[model samples]
Target: MMFDNKKVDSGTIGYFDTQQENHFFDRKSARIAVAKLSQSISAFANADGGELLIGVEDDKTWRGFASVEDANPLLDTAFDRLKSGYFDAEFLNSDHFPGFVLHLSIERSPSVVYSTSDEAYIRNNAQNKKVTGERLDSLRRSKGDITYESHAIPASLEDLTNSETMIHFMLESDRISEPSEFLRKQGLLIDGNPTVAALLLYSDHPQGQLPHAGIKIYRYETSGEARRDFLSGVPLTIEGPIYTLIRRAEETAQKIIDSIPRLDQGSGLTKIEYPVETLHEILTNAVLHRDYGTRDYVHIKIFDNRIEVESPGRLPANITPQNILDERFARNPLIQRGINRFPDPPNMDIGEGLNTAFQAMERLRLNLPYINESGDHVRVTIPHEPLASPQEAIVNYVRESGRINNSTARTVTKIEQERTIRRYFAELVDAGELAQRGSGRGTYYEIP
Candidate 1:
């Protein structure tokens, strides 16, 4: 079965020729057994989801099926073995191909997917790893694919019902049901024990149950690496229920950020400004989406030039740094929903927190925040670096120092070329932002 009569360059097949099997892409011969193909389907759906080309061999050769009828066995297993809507299948052929290439694009399932033999698998790098025991449970917990938030804990129902937080929430929501009944209806209380979500939402000290559930904020004096010598004061621990914890952490961090000063044009030294929305969203996400399984609190480190928020988990589910703004997964759905019920909730827009933060940073002309997934953690760095142009930098430098020469402009803007600095000065002068004072070796520019 050929793709179409339409002709395309043989080089177009390079997509398969140069494609190496990785976490997101894999190729297999069409003669592979049904069970093995099922494993690949289960793996891609379990991990971040990926593309699988079933008609290609390990050595980058396109060994497609002889005909559409011959591909039915594999197609049936791919579709029938998994739940509907998990993947899409298409056949491809070019002027250079001898058979039809079966392409399957799988999505990361919200629930774990099992193969035909009921074995669960997850894709890791280039291999389909059969997951069991702790690894399987860890997979379920990541991105709230399974409902870990509703898992029962040792805390009593009274721990949630008697809390002042719950009481206020009930009153504000205008609910007349008893606190225990209300919590039970919300799936927060099971049997006689409070669930994880109930404890985090209503208990006075959720940290009492989950010791590492709160946040720790630190300030470093240096703009470089964080070391013992650069540490400012003692780290501040923000502990409470999830709602209070988020607010306290945000306010405290903002206060420290506000105290930092920067040189501005004509304003002299002014309070350094980073979009408040950016801090709020990132901080809120760091708390709500972090992995509770890890025995560490969310760490917020403030440096001279940036703020770093390290959450105690990798980006959940199919989420990667590149697609964080576009993907939505709640590691703790109940906690997220409960907080949204608060008066003027911390997360005003569900699933749009990071998107809001990115937009806010762009509006301020600041570089977008950097997100990286470390081993057991995800770190987001909010840099204070501006997107000002070279001419603007020169004008600002002259305004702050009363004068800027070629050497000084080069040093301030970090543009190593003296000619580039001179061009910037010329543009600033043409724009009337700076006035040339003299020529020859004594040349200097000052703000007009």
Candidate 2:
């Protein structure tokens, strides 16, 4: 069969595509390319599908190969691998290279493609990497058209809290057309037995079944050191029903927000400089997407100027920072759905929470949210800035008066007189140009 050279376009050079100086070619070795091909296929399937042209150059250079006679045998071997049921592969058309080139097209079905060993891979940017370890585990548990969300949990009926589970079932039931039947079809509860995911979401004491499921909130008074004190704050540990846990987390977050002094905007408006919705979205996301399989719980660290919410798990399969907003791979579908049933659940649609937080920050004209992933944990830091512009007033006060109290600073910056001068004090303190006097009400801030 003859192949049409016009069909292929220039792409990057990697395991999946071979460079011919000018054009690119798909790797010819069935055994050698199968692994990378599987990853490319999986990534495309996981994301918006795209074409994978072989025998092309990274810089759009194309050097035509011999002919179909030279590439057909390799193509046959590759097709056999797909037919074996170890992976999902499709044959598009070879018209592109009628005689001189070979073209193959693969599509992703709702079914996940696995290797002979049942291992999966996802493409990262231009590279195909194995989706293993925690990342893979999280992906396997994700909710998607062909994912395993419909599967039942392994435990017995006694493992679940029926009353609590029914409440969630009822709430979700009202939204869908057929609640009970849908629950049965989704394998949420079989023969009145809760699936592992169901138990985690609705059980009064989900931790009894999945002890690792919980949220850890910590407050630290930094002494300008890396590791410092347990200090004057409390560490709130919450577990049990997903609904209760979310509520507790939100309440805990609010308490931490309350602890930080509010800006004294002289105006009647009580606007927080940092978007409260942004904080809610980040914290809610941490709880929803966290990997419950790991013993580590979600952690919230309240520092002087910023709050960091660290969830236990890394990015889901085939997900990265660039495409995080465009695509969403929920680590816990059951938990996600359960949270949504709450009076105010988080927005997980297409990973919009992160984007919402970002937009909110941009609206407030504050710094961007800080995201860090280490090992199996993802930490998001949101800093609190002054709601009203205080730099000029702060500089004037410091330069003229030489010092000012928390109250005096706000007085000088009349822009928004109600906001406590604490924000200005914190900025100055962070800059190493301010010091505090006395304690409590007697405490006053002055330029040092």
lDDT per residue as tens, model 2, 325-400: 6776776676577566656555545367888888788667577787866656778888776444576667667778
Determine the backbone clash count of candidate 2. 41
Give the per-residue lDDT digits (tens) of candidate 1, residues 24-104.
999889899988888998899877789988777777777788887788888788767556666777778766767888888
For model 1, give the 10-residue run with minimal summed lDDT: 1-10
Clashing pairs in 1: none
Off-target runs (Cα >4 Å) in candidate 2 are 1-151, 154-186, 225-234, 261-273, 329-334, 344-352, 385-448
| lDDT of all predictions | 0.83, 0.59
What's the count of clashing pairs in each model shown?
0, 41
Error of 2 at 334 (Å): 4.3
Q: If scored against the real structure, what TM-score would every candidate get?
A: 0.73, 0.53
